[model samples]
Target chain A: MFSLLQQAASTAAETDTHAAPANAEAAAAAAAGQGADAAHAVEAAGAAAHAGEAAQSAGMPQLDVSTFGNQIFWLLVTLAVLYWVLSKVALPRIGAIISDRQGAITGDLMQAEEFKKKAKDAEAAYGKALADARTEAGKIIAAQKAEIQTELNTAIDKADAEISARAGESEKRIAAIRDSATADARSVAREVTAELVRAFGGKADEAAIDAAVDARLKGAA
Target chain B: MATEADTGLAFHPMEQFVVKPLFGDGPIYWYTPTNATLWMGLTLLAIIALLVFGTRGRAIIPSRVQSIAEMLYGMVHKMVEDVTGKDGLKYFPFVMTLFCFILFANYLGLLPKSFSTTSQIAVTGVLALMVFVGVTVLGFVKNGTHFLGLFWVNSAPLALRPVLAVIELISYFVRPVSHSIRLAGNVMAGHAVIKVFAAFAAIAWIAPLAVLGIVGVYALEVMVCIIQAYVFTILTCVYLKDALHPSH
Candidate 1:
């Protein structure tokens, strides 16, 4: 690289026709010391060095007064445009978008809270309704049990009365049989007594026989 | 170094900072569009794209570009509020303009062939001067002669107060000069060092180190660029606070 730079400087010194910039003069002097091809390579390097020098400015380009006016002018123009655009359009728009997002989030959170409350309310109502239905069911079951018990007691009482009435009728029938048997016996006894009397040539009294038979049936009973 | 072109290793670092007409070689009028103008215009377009068109959706869920815009907005907004207090918000638009412009200018200047507008002393001087002048005016408007109390050190002993006042007054006046130089100097120094390192690539023995040095400096320059922009803005806010509440 050093050799090539020396070679370019050597040629540029010979070929360069324009006024020498600072670095080029030093390069030209160094090339003079080396003393090589101050020949046709001169033409080749001439254009390049000139272009480079044209691209460069002396000293600090930062302090260049010639460009200051142009820089400041454009700077002011750009700032004005940026300031106008920002203050009027960009800032307000961004602020609004941010606030709008905040509002949307707050609204969503509030809605979620409301739904949670509704769910809680529904749960409570469901529990209350379940309890009420259970109580009503218990009441109905107790009432049905009492009604069945009353019906059973009435049926048993009527059965007992019918059984007692049949027993009384049987008792009366038995008594009547006993009385008829008594009368038959009395007649038989009287007949017997009269037969005995005829055999012994004595007559028996019917009235007296009836009385004795009656008294004997009564004693035997 | 200029003759090193034959070795394919000629690097003019300051040449990159030169302001030239973009169209043709001629005298640059105050209005003639140059590379400086081009980069400045690019900065504006970048700011617009990020802070304007990027936020076109205005979505509740911000896109990447919109989030970046909001982040910048919130950062500067909070800085102003923190330093200058609530009253300072009245000048938020002004402060926002300064921060965004400097930030974009610094970042854009880092491009391969881009010119750094913030690295220009003339430009930073104008920026600092605007802040200094505006704040001074605001101080007087807000608190008449009592604004001068900023220089008067009541905390000092009566015998030492005058000495402190003189120091305060000079430091107060030096604010704009230091403000402008600090930014331009840092950026210009970083860029110039990188260029010098790049020029070393002409020698084979040092080429690797030169490339590494360039990379390292480039990274640092990127950091310095944003930091300088931040420092410039924060200093402005401090000055504004002093003006708004000068009694202390």
Candidate 2:
């Protein structure tokens, strides 16, 4: 297993080294090419100088400028300018944009976390408030129920007392009326008995009958 | 020792190092350095100087210069934020260094006959290696043994485990190749096209073809410069994101 792993590692190393020669060749080509361009420009300038002299003989003052070196120089200068542009200006701006974005994102994440915490707190408070309200409502309901029960009991007791007092008064009045009617009834019965006794005086039993009649009349009156 | 070609091309050097000959390439090359190394060294120095000057006092209320400095910081800061989220902020210095280095190197190469460090595969490979090793190490350090779990992804069913693992491993290993190749290819191809066009102007009297190529490549190179820098930083962010949150 170790050997197999080593083989794999060696293969990877092999691929890495394989790229070296090609890179060196390309670098050589690039460096050599630039040198060749510069030499060509010098040759062209020398040719132009010869041509200008030839033209001057024909009544024209021709100028010969080495576009070759100028181009190379300017190209270099342009590259420098580009480097400065990116390093000093463009990159900095890009960097700023990136940082601002990061700040915004981080700020947003922190803000979201804060909001979530607040929401949780709010939910907890709401739950507590709800529970407290329910408890208070329960207490109020229980107290009211107890109070109503007590009130009903008191009202029932008052009604029972009133009914009993009315019943007592009614009974007393009935007893008094019955007593008066009984007296009236007894007087009528006694008068009828006395009348009847007077009508049959000669035919009635003597001393016993007189005593019974007197006792009954006194009791009836 | 000057060749006819050497007379045409100018001198510019950056940094120097040893190059051991592989197989039959003769003796090893030691620090008989060239212009390429010098420029690379100078590029590094320039970057350091700018950053140092820019961050000297670090005022909350920025001056004109401070604004430019802050802008650079902000750009990298934003890139990290977008790609890596809040955790990216911790890697601000590193990411910024990378962005500035890449941007400066690219721009510097555009100077007349200047060496492009990124044009070389060794340089690109080194950069890619730095990112790869750095990110991988960071992943392991952050997640410990859990980082290995990033390879397996056994979250899938038993039936698919082998296939997914293989695919993930291939992609993971491919990161450095693609990263290095992309930067080096762009730089190389861009310079090559410009060189070819410049050569055409030297050879023949055709104005349109050479001029168009020169102008067009100039514009294209400008875009590539920014794009490559962005690509580098963004990838860094993505790698960092993976490091911080390895589940993905």
Candidate 3:
């Protein structure tokens, strides 16, 4: 198509150049007389040719049967190159990066989960330890309370036995003093009755005096 | 429009889409590189810059380009998995290539004077046909005879089953056509509309309005470019899902 257009353009140019010198005077006079009209016709022709080319190439080049093979060939080449680059080079690298990031994230999460479990276990152990200490403290307190109660009971029993022994000894000593005083009083009453019988002409009754003194002393005690 | 161009007040919008030979005005042979090839090469370079060179760092903490590369990778990967399930992820590379190629082509077309490779039906058609062929082959390979069950509507009444089956079969075949046309049509229309508005910007009275129209259309084209790429990739995933799991 391009060759044909070039041929037509060259032929037209050749005719214009060939005819110009030969009929220069006549053509010049004619051109001056109808210059605008001639120019209009030439412009119209050029525009028509341009419009024809444009129209030929215009609406859809895909509909053109002649260029299909070339277009298809180039398309295949480009697509093949693209597929090679994407599949072999770009895609695999990108996929690797994404999966690597995912793996890192998953690893971190697993570690965190392990830490959480450890923390939970530690908390449970601490709670168990605290409960054991409390129970042990309670047992210690109960044992000490029982021991204090037994010691208090033993001290009370010893104090009560000492007070009873002291009371018994004091009672025996008071009885002995009372008996000695009563014997001394009986001797004094017999002596006083004998002295009275010597001084006067009456005989003293020592035995009777002694008996009375003894009876009086018994009543007083 | 012809008179407008004749008066030198307008431009040929479709001229941009022409597949001219890059070096000379020679006839384009099958191997002759053209403007389409140049832009496609550029798109490939862009992909290489993003995917291969950008990810050369391989950093655990990605650099800017690496970040973008990774984001694209993750986006397409997740999209495939979500749309087609884990079993369908085996085809992630193919789907990713389709997405990146179309996406870069569409975006590169937005550059001044750059040709949109995806805007051509030849390109989009090939891509869609590849997906179709790949998915269909995968279906048969995985499920063997059961792949045919995709066309059968068992839930339908006995009388309506065959009718539903025919409809399903036609729609299934039509997927490639619609898929190719949707991308090419959208990209071409957007670029052509922008060109039209740009040409109208030469007019003094409506120059501001024309500029506004171009801006609006360009913005919409940006969105359309990305969305069309996404649509193509997702559809590929859906088809792969059908291939992997050939149930209703």
Candidate 4:
């Protein structure tokens, strides 16, 4: 099997060498004539060579170009392929990435602006809340002070009424004491004069005597 | 118009200028034309004109000139992307600008009596050296001594590492030489071929040779101009990729 494979490889190599010579000859001939027929003849010769080789090589005939020319040709082809791939696939992706980064920067700026606005609003809200707290506290303190003052005023008025009623009752008690004392004192003196007149048998001018005696007793006391 | 023979092209290498001043003492700097400076100046003017025209008014959608500029931008952008994967995009502008400058210089040289800036070895060498030094500096700056990993082949077995490293080192050092030679050789050879064919046009019997030579050389030169530009840009992309990713 290996020998057969080796023979086949040698034969393939031979056919490739033959095919290249034929193509080169045709290329030289085509290059020689500037006319239209020469162009067709070159193509026809290449086609005929390919056809003849195709029948012998199990449907896989090697190409008929020098390795250097082939390399140069393929270099161009690969370069074009590379250019296409870069232009179509890779470049757009990179451009998108750059655009995305740019968008991110702009978005960050806008977000910062938004956050600044929010912060300002929060500051205003806090200020209003603090102001409202101060006003509410002031109102509460004022209300508390008014309630305390009213209670104090009510207590003072009740204390003054109690003191006034006690003073009036004391005065009435003193007036009663004075009037009773004077009436008792006058009756006691009259009784004392009658007893003296009854005892001494000289009961004349009791009122004058009583008056003189009362005057003399009052002067002595 | 001086022909090749009259232009002293037959002089030995570096004999185009010789000082012999006993007969009439003089300075040649004043009389000798500065081809290098003159061509560079012309290229700069061309670049300025292009930039001025292309960017006269910025548009989201491109005008003709703008589109042409964008097409160039797109070409370099894609080239960088492919050769360097995604990372090479950062150097797109630099690489693209270089490609555009060299390409325009080459294309302009194809015109009658126009100088090819890249045809000169010094110019090509300087540009290649810039790329080489830039890439090397970037590798060192970004990766430090670890950039040597590019040549170390850490993936290789320890036994084979020395050999691989040596080979890679040689190849790495040869990059600038290859790059400069490839561009300079292509441009110089294409121009030389064209010049030879143009000279052949003066002969009657050699008219056919001239025609064939002109057509083939012209066709080939056009391809060479574009390929050299692509190769230069792609190499830049590859070098930048190495700078960015030192392991490979």
Name the best candidate (by TM-score): 3
DockQ of candidates 1 onward, in order?
0.30, 0.01, 0.25, 0.00
lDDT of 2 at A120: 100
Interface alpha-carbon RMSD, every candidate: 4.9, 19.3, 7.4, 21.4
Give candidate 1 misplaced runs (Cα > 4 Å). A1-58, A153-221, B1-11, B23-29, B152-164, B246-248
**Interface RMSD of candidate number 4:** 21.4
Ranking by lDDT: 1, 3, 4, 2
- Looking at candidate 1 chain A, the ten consecutive residues that score lowest on lDDT are A39-48
TM-score of chain A by itself in each prediction: 0.56, 0.48, 0.58, 0.53
Report the lDDT tens digits of candidate 4 across residue range B1-248. 13334642321111111111223333223222243344544654565455445545555444776556556656777778887889667666567556766777678777766656576554566668778998999999989999999988877899999999999989888999899879977887677677666666767788788889888988899998988988998898889999989976
Q: Write the per-residue lDDT of candidate 1 for residues B84-186, one digit (tens) a residue.
A: 9999998988999999999999999888778888888878888999999999999999999999999898987999989989999999999999999899888
Q: Report RMSD (Å) for each prediction in the order shown.
A: 9.6, 17.9, 9.2, 19.4
Q: Which clashing pairs does model 3 show?
A: none
* TM-score, candidate number 2: 0.48
Return the lDDT, model 2, position A99: 65
Judging by DockQ, tell me the better candidate of 1 and 3: 1
**Native contacts kept, each candidate:** 0.65, 0.00, 0.55, 0.00
Q: What is the TM-score of chain A in candidate 3?
A: 0.58
- TM-scores for every predicted model: 0.74, 0.48, 0.78, 0.48
Better of 3 and 4 by lDDT: 3
Quantify all predictions' global Cα lDDT against the true fold. 0.79, 0.61, 0.77, 0.61
